[model samples]
Target chain A: MMKRSAIAFSAITATMATAGVVQATTLEDVKAKGFVQCGVSQGLPGFSNFDDKGNWTGVDVDVCRAVAAAVFGDATKVKYTPLSAKERFTALQSGEIDVLSRNTTWTQTRDTALGLNFTGVNYYDGQGFMVRKDLGVKSALELSGAAVCTNTGTTTELNLADYFRANSMDYKVVAFEKADEVVAAYDAGRCDVYTTDQSGLYAQRIKLKEPDAHMVLPEVISKEPLGPVTRHGDDEWFDIVKWTLNCMLNSEEMGVTSANVGDMAGSDNPGIKRLLGSEGDAGKNLGLDPGWCEAIVTQVGNYGESFAANLGPETPLKIERGLNALWTQGGIQYAPPIR
Target chain B: MSTNHDISTAPAKPPIWNDPVYRGIFFQVLVLGAVVLFGLYIFNNTAENLERQGIASGFGFMNTTAGFGIITHLVEYTEESSYGRAFLVGLLNTLLVSAVGVVLATLIGLLVGIARLSKNLLVSGIATVYIEVIRNIPLLLQIFFWYFAVLRSVPAPKNSIALLDTFFLNNRGLYSPAPMPQPGFMWIVIALIVAIVGIIIMRNWAHKRQERTGQPFHTFYVSLAILIGLPALAAIITGLPLAWEYPVLKGFNFQGGLVMIPEFVALLLALSIYTGAFIAEIVRAGILSVSHGQTEAASALGLRNNITLRLVVLPQALRVIIPPLTSQYLNLVKNSSLAAAIAYPELVSIFAGTVLNQTGQAVEVILITMGVYLTISLTISLFMNWYNKKMALVER
Candidate 1:
């Protein structure tokens, strides 16, 4: 009976989808709804996870808040939908969420093929392996013929295979759907190695029964530019999301912390003036308020602050800002100039 | 003259709306129109949503490279294969597991069902407890229990338990020697086919002899010898031409063998065992539905106990069993999608779960997956319907 109905439903949907023009403007939707629908991960420490009081907090979560601030001048005016890895893309594509800020890796296939535009990198990550220190495996090169555990719906598995195959190493994979399952299997010694993004390795390592017993190998296999994603065609909404993160980065580069954003707004810095809407029409051109960047910087602080708050050395994950640091600070995290 | 006019006008046809046949046709047309309108509305909404989001709506993505590896595929597959190929691999894997599970579950179910009706009190009681215990627990939990609790506790690959220096068991999986077929394997297959044909001929001849002379022949023993003895004789004549690729520990894990991943083992075990319990109850009911008089009548015809069962009860009982049994087969096939939970690389896990995530073509991927399952289910039902018709009692 269920199957019969499902078939009938699909047939109807198929007919209805023919040549119909559905023009989706996420900016308009968010404005009309009074809140941005943000798609987030089910839970990933320091990326998108709940706090002690059940409030969502993470670098990825903060990206959505920044977008919300840019759009509505209110950082808290956003509702999060926790999505599994498999459901995130569809949720975004189907317009179920205005923006997907779920630590999704920006890839060529996703950006072009899946009709998604990655706004900007919130976290610079790479595929890395984690193994027990007692295994006498100091490097990833020693992991030939190892049974590796990883999450199924992730690029980590593909990267693992690529890295191994390129090096002509034979290995076995034991993949799970959920991150916690992979961690559990790794913990239970079901596999010799656990592989994922380096940040995820640090995050999940803390969940292990004995955190110090495992060591992350010193090899970065693939570049993972984790960022928020939006629908491809809405250039206006795309600019809003993209510039929201850029505002944070540009603020950090200009040394304008959240506490001193107001003071710096009055400064003689022409770049700051333009970014804060004191001088130009950059924000207005993107269909947002003139003070859009100001709201982002004032409410969510700069990118460094968001990073420090969620994933800095003080946090449980204790991930350092390596490639995530500004280009001037010997890192590749550079945003285009506001002027 | 007024009564004649009323009759000539067909009682004014009661108006078309008041006519029963017209009303029925009108209602059906209304319902059909409403359904089509509703369908158009949803499709238009989805199309607008896709167009608005700039998501491409089509099956063109199937041609793109999959760029991933499947752990165990029956067919040759590579990371460089197209999404279409990957989908085929997933489909085949799903069918393979379902087919194997169906056969195993039927065997176990039949045995348990027979045991449940045994004269021995302990045997029947144990069978009842087994049925009740397994039937009540959810299959997903059973899969989890086997995967997480039982399988995960096994020793790691470094300390794999070696059985007879041929098989290796570890947390990763059970690894045994894989048979490498030699050139003579074809002849052995041919020999088995010939033996089957020979058995059929033998059975026909025995039946005719019995009818003519009122004498019985042990067709079962003769058939069994032909089947087993022919294969053995072929293997001997062919010098037993086969090599074994035994699993050997190299560095961190075993290599060079047929490795059955623990996830698949757990999923198959869970699906088969769980479905088997329900099947057992169905079998018991089916057997009981065959009246006691049938058995008594067969015995009165001087047929022995085994012959009575094989010739009388089973064929009749099958007709009562088939409809529900068809549903169970469908249930098992659908349940095999639970392989996703265990990451066994079946249709749901690979093509639907991972490929959907990678491609982000949810509608297309889901449609294809649904179509595959629907096709499988419809085919099974059609086959079972034919079998049921054939097995039904023939009446003059």
Candidate 2:
């Protein structure tokens, strides 16, 4: 925890130091540097977290690993820069990080006004409210006059205001800059309700002293399509990140798993052949090796595999793939074909 | 002397670099040119970067809707308020916290400073411990201690700790009765103003009479009576035109009162306490700067200890204290920006953090935020300079 706060403070100073340094041709820069400096959240379980041994994991981390695999054919050829929400964009804009995959929402203002390009939604999420079950608040409509705790510099605070005001309910918002501080405040009963993205709510619920005492309400207030973000002007880097997600989604749609990717490489299906770069020059088009898809699958796995590995029902967070499942699997995760 | 006569011959005129007046002007111009170039370099880089990234560069975003709610705003604000209004609200909150912290910290610091000078061991020892402990720790950690560790430990609002039936304390905040002035409150206000004018005139007359007749009057007692007694009389004649809106536990938290959130409490406590330690040392140094001869001289004239310290020692010490004391005041105000860490809705946290994030106008938002702090520092320094002048020694 001490190391984490120290990193956060340093990240702030680092962002300030590198402010307004334009990083164009980021693809060339990464290729020359031999690694992608990926900006991730300080620590959000089921998204991006650093373990005791300082290894990064989760869906967001896998996005960076996949990009590294596509670029250098090695998943380990990547570095992590943990950023707070307030520092994330500045870090990205100032060239501190090649790509920001910190579970950030893809809103219109951020996409247009913030000089950011949201490649594609890696996780389709929404604003959610969690409350202690003993409060007898079964639904969000019953949460009038409740004090809500959320992190600053995010859309959660704004969404909470819109939701409560639309429902004609009075509420107080207690915002903290750090995610853990919000969790701590909510756990300590400093607020009556905790609101954020649904995935975040599930992840932070475990931090409470009595995790079983809380229940997430059924209402989702806002559309929070979270994805990897790159600077707006760098079309090549944007294509690299966008295709990385599409490749993962397409591979999953084609029934490719990390365990069977090697065997599927020899398959006779033209679509599979084209996707794995065994028969087509799709990887060449993106300035990558021919076997870029194979490298990503063999190293990181498909989108579903990454999700089940990090946030499935068997995992601690137990987040369901309500909207993140593949198109054929009765969910909204659709990807463009490799061809 | 005749042997070294050739060495005394007039030397050749030196180069411009060796001429002190020319060198000073040349170096000053060089420095000014370098500074201007450096500033323009950054400006060009920022403009290019912003243009390349498609970030709009201007103050136009200030008029956009903030779409956020503030916990405690001095003026009216809602989600509908523009970002400009939100900036003003944040500025007011920052000034409010810093001003209150300055007053509270000065009082505590003065008391602690004087106690450290006490002959009693326990009193001085406690003051010493406080100064050492508080001054040694980082202010951010102290703020975290008060916020996450102390204030967050308070009980929930349902079981709020009541204070005098008009105040409540809970994890949410401290609730105190908000005074509501009625129609007749105007007459009381007018009466208080009249009493102040009357007292000022009386003080001037008393000073002249004392100088003429050498007969001292009880000016302090008379001034106190006029200030308080006039207000009391007006209130009674107007049937007590002030009402207290006591906080009641209506729903989730206290209502109908002035609420000070835990964020405010923790920020105020941390800033004041941490700054207070530094101030205590300053006060101690200032007091010690006064020579003991002044105190002995006063005692020789048969003045009491308190009177001698106030009339003789403090006046001299003020000269030493005012300069460094100005710096501490400025430091406290700037350090109040750390209120951003705990989500205190101060200038930096709200305007710089939320507005910057929402608008994505880093350059504009940061420039304006910096200007606010600059303005605040200048205002404080100007006020302190005037006060220092008023307290300056007038040597004959």
Candidate 3:
């Protein structure tokens, strides 16, 4: 009896050990699973917030949709796992998500040491401060000795500390783990100023009790290039996510909206035809179908369309596409050519 | 008859499998070997998986600069401090809240427990209601109530509620005067230590004298006088080697002084009150476990009411109270991890939450945090066991 049980125990241990040793095949895994698992923020307006009807609509959400469209030719073939700032990276690194489309800042250490790859910059943001209008604070430098509130486990907290120390000013930080708690703490006057990405400042402002009473300061402290991320060591899957974002940017620069992508597929311009998969093997090189770029543009829309629908002047956040505009329009959002 | 005796005396050996003792030993060895193999498998699997995922592993990340600010730190820390220092800061904050919570819980528990047995109906009723109400609610909700509902409603820094023109209370925190020690402050501290030592010796002498002469000396008042007098004399001789720095209103908030952030207050209040309710129940059970005969015997001996309760009944009741009370203390220490939910900068909040996120080294950070909590819990258990041994009944 003892010998038999021992043999069984060894078998169980061997199987358990081998279970975790499977090689990284995220693209194949996603294909077999029939949907791409995307990680996003818990709730950041104009970035990754869900509506009352349980439908998520945001600029970051569109990235995941584009990847899903490129992979499955179906934009809705995606599942989102809402994560906090602390849980986002671990979720992607552990294979819990195929891609992390959260508004995560791209930093050197994260790209090199964290075993993750940043696909491309989706938004160019900078750390900014927001204060009550009655505080009479015009610039971030003027707000010395202020109690600052921000979310923990993010670049915002580090940026706030660096900005104060460099300016020879003393400050108190009241950081919370969740964005909602930070908003509540700031609204309760627990802090004198709320600091985060300028876009985040605008996004979180709407959550305040009196959104109009708060104003974002003019100074930008740190460069925050926000983008989507995927696990490293999987070049095939990485290329798919990277080129999916590139497809959106390239399509926008070519003036191909979701409304006009079908007609542009047959255009005489070789650049447009190759981008739409009618003239070159761009899609095959990434191990995707021939019409992957076309699928992304038609189903999820280009970068400009997603930005306009989710975060443009017509939306509640009313964010202008200044740094996010195409390079031809004098912004820095230039993508590599499709050819 | 001799042949029958010789035949019976010859013993027969059983097979190894049929021998109960050998079977037990064999099975035990098998189980131990299996457990060892399982543990080895898990360790190897984790190492392989971490390597396969390309996520860095090890404690080297602790040497890197933390580059962040913590709100409540007991020791000197800065943005340039190492992550190891950040861990220490977080550990100290956790220790502070847990230590204060344990003391306050014991005091409140003792008071409420005795009150529940009081003859006065109102006092017992109130105590009973307090235990039922506080212990039944979830601790996290209580924390939220204290933080958001109670402290958040306080006035802001601009209109801080001033006390004695030195201490202030506002939504940000409670600011008070901080003592800045000068060169001769060491002499005053030495004086205080000497006074404490003197009090301990006097108490020992007083206990012996009372036993021999059957007359008690007033040791409490004498000890109190020495404790204060020695410190005061040293301060006068040293020309007062301490200066008080009061908090003053500056640009946006209070400038200098000691401050207790609201997060600490809310967490401490919630932990103390919640644990107090459980301790109160344990105390009541302990007191009731002592038979009624002991109380009646004390009364028959003509002891006063308060004296009989304190000297006779309490010593017996404590034997029953301590073991369970130790468990409550352990629970409070472990529950302090909930401070993460409210951003109290405790070990789990700042170290495991923020540091783990920043470095992406979840395995190492979580292991270190768990190890710290284990060490703290074991220390508390060791101390409590020693205390329990002292209070145990000694039979003649």
Candidate 4:
């Protein structure tokens, strides 16, 4: 009887879906709602978190605002839906949110298999372990037979295992489901080590009562390039997001700033002219007005401004621009020419 | 066979259009046809979409090397290992957490549930509070509480909290002595199995003797003696061969112990505490559903409270409890999927999240995950149902 009812319900649901009762393009619905419904992190400090007045801030959060600035010309034109790692993908796939801009790592499977389009790398991270400084452990190699704490169901878990086996270390693993619990178990002296991305380890460390006592190990075991992601099959929307990031990177490269964007829009530099929509039909080619990139730059500021505001040395996160700097400056940040 | 024929014939005599049996069959056929048609349509559309994008579909990529790095794995794997191997390792990890979580949850749950009904108000209240606090919060939140707030506070490896001389706890995980197997371990295992078989036979004999001659044997004491005595005798005969590979305070961390990571701890604790709440309610209902008169009569017969519970109340209560409790257990096993939220590398994390991304076979990956979970749920239900039937009273 239950099975029969379930089948009927499913059939009705399929019929409704097939009959176009629900539009598949949530991107349009989001625009109609006057805001991009972006899923972000609950609170990872600089990556994504709430501020003093409960306003969301962070490098990842800025990505959402940038998209909104490009789409709606208002940086604040977005509804933030804070999501954990597990719920983020499903929420995007299910159309519960428009784009996932959490501190999510961009991987092959999440990009291709989960039908997600990663806009671009926002933060480059790597899996590293943290332990108390008094442990005097210099390398992860000394972690053999250690009770290593790591979060379950993540690339970190797999990376932890691979790192250990590759180094021929025989360690015991303590797996948890949240970053907070890993810290708690560590705080209660339950586990001997904690493992996560270097950035997360830093973000989580600040919340600890005595943050100074622990130290993140120097060796980053695995690469964890975190980025923003969108659903697949919407090329127009994907391009909009991708170029939003590109525009930010290009804005910084072209010496544009939130303070100077308006004045420099009439500048003579051709690359800047094209990027700020003062010259060339670059935005037209991408199916948007010539002013789209200008709106993104003026409203959302450049990538450097966003970075410094959220995670740079000025903020509480105090993250250095190790690899996030411009390509000409020996950093990885580079965007193709607007032409 | 004759009855089936008669049943078929009984409803077939009327016109095919008005026949109830034929109508049922026709409706079923229509529903089945619609399902197939819908399924085919979706399949066709997806295929065309993929083809338009020039994305080939197949599980042929299973053997392809996965370039992604994994943090930890039980078996050997590298970036060069096949995706299939990576998936298998992931499945093992999932099973590993579920198996461990199940055992621990049951132990803690049974204790707390019974404590809630204890004569002591303090104990009952504590148990009640435990259930209430864990039950109301989302399991994910609980897991986060354990992982971040709890484990992150531990001292580093060198300043580890020593438990006994051999075990140590630090921010990492629980490190205890891992028994390095010796030659006599097999004999010990065999002796333990023999003891179990003997106990089962002894229990049957005790039951039969009680039924036939009204003679009751103390099955517990006899089983305990057999279980311990046989293992001891075997060990002694094998020269009492045993060695403890105790974890020691090595250079920076403990060495030679079976370590349980903090992440696994948070997952287990959250999973157990969360599911145990529902189990407690199930147990309470099962216990309360048994008439009070049964307990009162057992007391009237001069049976001790423990004996009364063991012999009368519990046996009946289990009949009501087992089926529902099994579902709770299954729910727990499924909820372990949340291990991904914290990166526990259960099915969703390792296979669906990791492997599918690397391989790009979304359908194959998702189907496998769904199938694995369904199989696990079915097996657990079947086992519990069998146990429930066995415990059920045979009233004449």
The candidate scoring highest on TM-score is 3
Leading candidate by DockQ: 3
Question: How far does residue B141 in candidate 3 sit from its true spot (Å)?
Answer: 1.5
TM-score of chain B, candidates 1 onward in order: 0.89, 0.90, 0.95, 0.88
lDDT of each: 0.89, 0.90, 0.92, 0.79
**Residue pairs in steric clash, candidate 1?**
A16-B43, A22-B48, A24-B52
Rank candidates by DockQ, best first.
3, 1, 2, 4
Off by over 4 Å in 1: A1-24, A262-268, B1-53, B119-121, B295-312
Summarize candidate 4's per-residue lDDT along A41-146 as a digit string, tens digits: 7678888888889799888888999888887778889999987555576677657888899877787767775678888988888889888887778887888766
Clashes of each: 3, 0, 0, 75
* lDDT (10s digit) by residue, model 1, range B144-255: 8888875667888777788999988998789999999988788888999999999999999999999999899999898999999998999999998888999988999888
Extract clashing residue pairs from model 3: none
Range of the 10 consecutive residues with the lowest summed lDDT in candidate 1 chain B: B47-56
| lDDT, model 3, position B224 | 96
User: Per lDDT, what order, best first?
Assistant: 3, 2, 1, 4
DockQ for every model, please: 0.53, 0.53, 0.67, 0.20
What TM-score, computed on C-alpha atoms, does each candidate reach?
0.90, 0.93, 0.94, 0.77
DockQ of 2: 0.53
| Candidate 4 docking quality: incorrect, acceptable, medium or high | incorrect
lDDT for model 4 comes to 0.79
Give the i-RMS of model 2 in Å.
1.3
Error of 1 at B46 (Å): 5.4
Better of 1 and 3 by TM-score: 3
Decoy 2 TM-score against native: 0.93
